[model samples]
Target: MSPQQKALVIPKKQGNFELSSRSIPSPGAGQLLVKIQSAALNPVDYKIRDAGLFVTHYPAVVGTDIAGIVEELGEGVVNFRKGDRVLAHGKFTNDFAGFQQYTLTDASFSAKIPSSESFDSAATVPLGLDTALVGLYGDQLGAGITPPWTESVGESKTPIVILGGSSSVGSYKLVKDYGATHFFDRNLSGKQLLAAISKVTDAPIELVYDAISLPETQSVAWELLANNGTLVLTLPASVKEDEGKGRKVIQTFASPHAPQNNELCQSSWAMVEKWLSEGTIRPNKYEVLPNGLEGVIGGLERMKLGQVSGTKLVAHPQETQ
Candidate 1:
């Protein structure tokens, strides 16, 4: 029999998660077998449980944010060796998922963790950062803006507004690190936020990344956007488009494995190591949950209830009993 590992499994669609055992999987070409050290919970984790949104298979494992150590390398994977500390964006498949003691990661979507960062911190970056990136740069899925890394896009002077939630410190810090010039308290009304933006620059607000994407926030973002401007949303747009105006609303899909986003994400993933090492990008602040994999259940419950805020909740998969 193959080696087995503890895993959190959902037995059916919209099923409760339970502790179970599964055989460890081997990495195929262009992949690495990873012993998961940390896995971070996102709102999507609970959403999948409640809505059965993505998974089609029974007894599925679903998690996407992961940081761990390389246990073995597969064919054609020359960038990493055994025991390297790494972080990866996991998939919904049982073998590739993060809610397990061991999982497989595609080499293209994985990056080495720098000495300055921890598994917990590294686990927070993949999902959120990729979502933001795809929303900003993807032509089909995003605003199709030139990425900041390209030659003198002149977006530095362009005014951009982000409508984030109250627990947006980590997100705020990330945008600032990437060149956001202004910050507003979430309590501000749409009119107040527009007024604040007016004082900062005379430039029309061309881009609004509605990270919150609530109906109230989306209404505000739609109101603030200029003619021909783009509003990027993390959720469905609650506001209707004005046909006469050239404005567009994009609800970004962040999966790195999506065919439309594959090349863009690969290029971005290539820069992640450098970004972390030089402090050009930083990880989100996180809180560790108790009881390893078992702790994930309660964490998901808290997320479902909107009880978790500001910080990412992480679980130690290795501590599973």
Candidate 2:
């Protein structure tokens, strides 16, 4: 029999999560068997538990933000070796998900965690950054901006607004590092926001990333976006854009496993180690939950209740009893 590992699983669609023993899965080609050290919770996690979105199988394990150590490598793997510390975006498949003590990571989606980063901190990055990357630069599911890594692009002179700058999932501070200036409260009404934006520059809002994407927030983002502009929503777009404004709305799916994101994410993942080490990208602030795998239930509840704010909640799967 294969070795068993503690995992948090939902027994059926929209079922409750419970601690279960699942067999440790071996990695296939281009995959790494990783011993998960940290798993970060996201809004989608709670949604999956409540609505079963994106999950097809019963007794499913979920949670995508993962950080861990490579235990073994499968055939044709060369970028990583045994015992390398890494962070990866977990897939919906139970064997590849992050809710287990051990899971498989595709080599293309995993990155070596730099010495400066910790498992908890690194755990907050994978999903969040991927969403932002796909929203900004992914050709298929995004705004289709030229990736800085792929080509020499000039600084964006137009005012770009990213709603939910402080959300735990995606941190947009990197925009400031390049050329973003001016800050405003996202709570402002659409007209108020438009007025505030007018105070700084008259350039029509060409790009708006509604990372929050709540109905109200989407309304505000759509208000500020000019014709021929692009509005990127992390969630499904709730606002219609055919009001004679050539404004394009793109709902971003950041899964590296998704074919639309594979190439874009691969390009970004290749630079993850360098970006974290050089401070081009930094992890979000996170709070560690207690009681190992069991604690994830309560943490997801807190997230569902809209209680968690600003900080990401992470769990230590190995700490499960």
Which candidate tops TM-score?
2
Residue range 1-321, candidate 2, lDDT tens digits: 999999999999999999999899999999999999999999999899888899998899999999999999999999998999999999999999999899999999999999999999999999998998888888889888888888888877867788887785447443456345777886799999999999999989999988889999999999899999999998887888785878889998989899988888889999999999998888888999999999999999998898987789999999998
Q: Which pairs, if any, clash in model 1? A: none
The pairs that clash in candidate 2 are none
- For residue 3, give model 1's deviation from the true position in Å: 1.3
Q: TM-score for every candidate vs. truth?
A: 0.95, 0.97
lDDT of each: 0.88, 0.90
lDDT of 1 by residue, 29-51 (tens): 99999999999999888888889
What are the runs in model 2 whose C-alpha is more than 4 Å off? 173-179
The lDDT, on a scale of 0 to 1, for candidate 1 is: 0.88
